[model samples]
Target chain A: MNRLSFLAPVALIGALLLIWQGACSILHTPEYLLPAPTAIVLALILNAPILALSAWRTLAMALEALVAASVFAAVLALLVSLSRTLDRAIRPLAVALQVTPVVAIAPLVVIWAGVDHPDRAIVALAAIVAFFPIFSGAVRGLTSADLDLERLFDLYGARPWQRLLRLRLPSALPFIVEGAKVASGLAIIGAVVAEFVAGSGGAEGLAWRILEAGNRLRTAEMFAAILTLALMAAVVHLCFQALEKRALAWWRGR
Target chain B: MTDVVAALLAVEVDYPGRGKALGPFDLALVSGEIVALVGPSGCGKSTALRLLAGLEGPTRGTVRRAAGRGETSVVFQSPTLAPWLSATANVALPLELAGVAKAEARARAVEALARVGLGAAVNARPAQLSGGMAMRASLARALVTSPRLLLLDEPFAALDEITRRALADDLLAIWREARPAIVFVTHNVEEAVYMAGRVIVMTPGPGRSAGETRVEAPTPRPSGFRTTALFRDAAEAISDRLAAATRAAA
Candidate 1:
């Protein structure tokens, strides 16, 4: 049932794209205004080097931001959770960051961090945006443990570190995986949005390249870059999804 | 002539939100003795086992044991096996927790599994186990500790009659070998009569030992013991006492 349900969306997406191209052709839209799927494919193939290079830059920034955010969030959450008063203070702040629009503040983040190191600025913004879910997930996972199991460990006179390693961490793995899955996608989106708002000079991500292509009325080029971003997002998403499944296998086995 | 085996020197428990102390009273769970503590629900039978197992602290008083150096092990009513680990690992949990090396623990866990007649089930996870199988694994785990005291909290209450009898027999075999002072808790009078050398019936509220009955059946009590007149007499007596207590509680 699940396998069949999963395939339904792929079939639907193909049908939707076919209809979109058919409608555009029937309307006789110019290539500059609305490029057919073939035109976008041709542009992507021709400008593969430039587009791929720019995509690499954005991918690199997003990945760096993701690693930094996950590590920082996990560590900070661990430390903050140790103190109840501090957890209470930080939880609301973390939630506020999750709710606030990163898009709205992208230009300000670029201006304040200086446009020269826009990749760094974009990464920092992405880090802030990505950190919250990991922080929340890790904290929830760390805290939710069985009291009976805890007592059983205590009965054995087990050390705190032993209990944490054997029981608490295993229990929290699913939550950690869930947080990372959500964080990875957001990291890529954050980096791309920041690039669009800040506009890179030479080290621009594909987002800025797309804007440049659009401003010059290179619609097919714009579509090609958008296609690359979509592909990258899908790839990152699939990676995290696989990781989440593998990480939670033990829990699911139970 | 012999040293005191297991003694509760004025032990009492009080959890502020949950309930009150069960006893400041005295009792001895002597070596090689199976002392069944029978009581109604929420009468502190479970809590008493927890305290004896050192899973919880007594608000006041002390629980003393005969062993010079050995970990106490418990068999809970529900098999609280780690769902992730296989049955063998679940049975090996005490050894692992005691810092016995993994390969050694697993090897020893195999011996314990064989004793519980779960030799084929050692690799199966808790999810793959039936209620009876899970309980048997828990019994294996408790015995593997080689404790001076083996505390059981109605460990067989959930099993079917056939499996329950088989497990009871296995428990007795383990008890005979290990010779730990077994403090078994249950509400079943027949089980107490069949398993224990002595049965202590507790009064319902804030539970305490209401009466003690001795069962002087010989060693290695056989399968036929359950049908014997002596067993019937012991069970009937305990049942009458329990009925009176329940009536009083009501």
Candidate 2:
């Protein structure tokens, strides 16, 4: 936003980094236990190629999950909206799915999809965990339109598809965008958790990297992968913001 | 076929929410005439207009029409301009929905906007518009169809004195050019007198037609005639009739 606000987070982060380094240096802590900022930076740099490949793989999975989740959510939302009976029948099931821990089902998903393309099962798990909000938010938003606006369409003799395309969809975009913002982070979390289980439930993802680093006492390498996930989250958030602005620029400054 | 032109032969209204019968609304809405339905709030004045527009169904009795949808257009009290649409785009929606090409509909929308003194505000969205500008857009949308019947539900009730009078004048000019059967609703007695050839006083709740008073004003009625004895007389008479109707209903 403004200079002061921008500087605030950076200042806080710099202070935290300084504190971490100072605490480690004073305690004479071993590098493996609490790595210094410089050591973390060096570890990140040295493992660049392998880390980059893993980072790309994770990014691709997040994107794939996001797209699949959104499409599935939209179709389900539309279908539910079109039928009162179906909405009643499916709402409880949806609520249950939303509340159930994806971590609990990670083993089951791995067992079902198996290790042929283990990442595919992980991606599917990620999509399931992230899709509910988009569907529910979109359905609610589309139906929240002022009743008078709908009546006006009828008075003007607009047909069903025309009303949906011109009015309902546009009205739902903001809600859908908000849902996507929330799902972005969750999707990555889902993929990582699924990867963790697939190793136990029996393949590999960034979670494997975190486990490998932890076992080998490579804390900085673990932090590097963690940083990559954080960066991916930030990128996804930025992408949604840019897309929302592009779609709704006409409503800018409202 | 009965050629009883310029009539609403015992129209009635109902809805699930508004459970009871609204009105057995009888009126002699003549051609080339302006009638004002004056009543308290929720008195079925707008409901009568809705029935006439065929937007709502009557529980009993008929809302007789001379012809189908092409014969009428309605202007709601709240402007009702589509918020997501620009002024020209909102006005053009009706024509476009009626199978007109986008360009032709927009052209007519522009012309209607000019008539309502909003020529320069074509690209402005409803959110950017003042109440008067948005109302003008609503009126423009109604007029663009060139219908034989115009249903206005307290169209100027939300405006200040200056804008209301300006809109009244603009509407009268448009009426003269188009010569539609206009049914204007209002709570303001003076406004009813200012705008209409006939003022129909209505009962307050569970409404019915109280009485109708005919004004002998000249065609394309003078906007300044609001200061004249005729206007005062009409307003006072309508007020008396409204009071009487409310008393009778009570």
lDDT of 1 at B215: 95
For model 1, residues B1-250, the per-residue Cα lDDT tens digits are 2455667766778778877747765577667788899989988788778777766667788888655334577777788887778888877777888889999999899889889889998889888889998898888887787887788889888888888878878888887787887899998888888889899998786777789999999756865898899999999999889888878979
Error of 1 at B13 (Å): 3.1
Model 2, residue A2: distance off in Å is 4.7
Best by lDDT: 1
Candidate 1 per-residue C-alpha lDDT over A125-237 given as tens digits, one digit per residue, 9 for 90 to 100: 88988898888889888887666666667777777777777777776778888998998899988988888777765457889879999999999999999999999889989
Candidate 1: where are CA atoms >4 Å away?
Answer: A1-11, A29-49, A80-93, A104-108, A201-203, A250-254, B1-3, B9-11, B19-26, B66-69, B83-93, B96-103, B120-131, B203-205
Output the TM-score of candidate 2. Answer: 0.90
Cα RMSD for predicted model 2: 3.0
Error in Å for residue A239 of model 1? 2.1
What is the Å distance of residue B74 in model 1 from its true position? 1.8
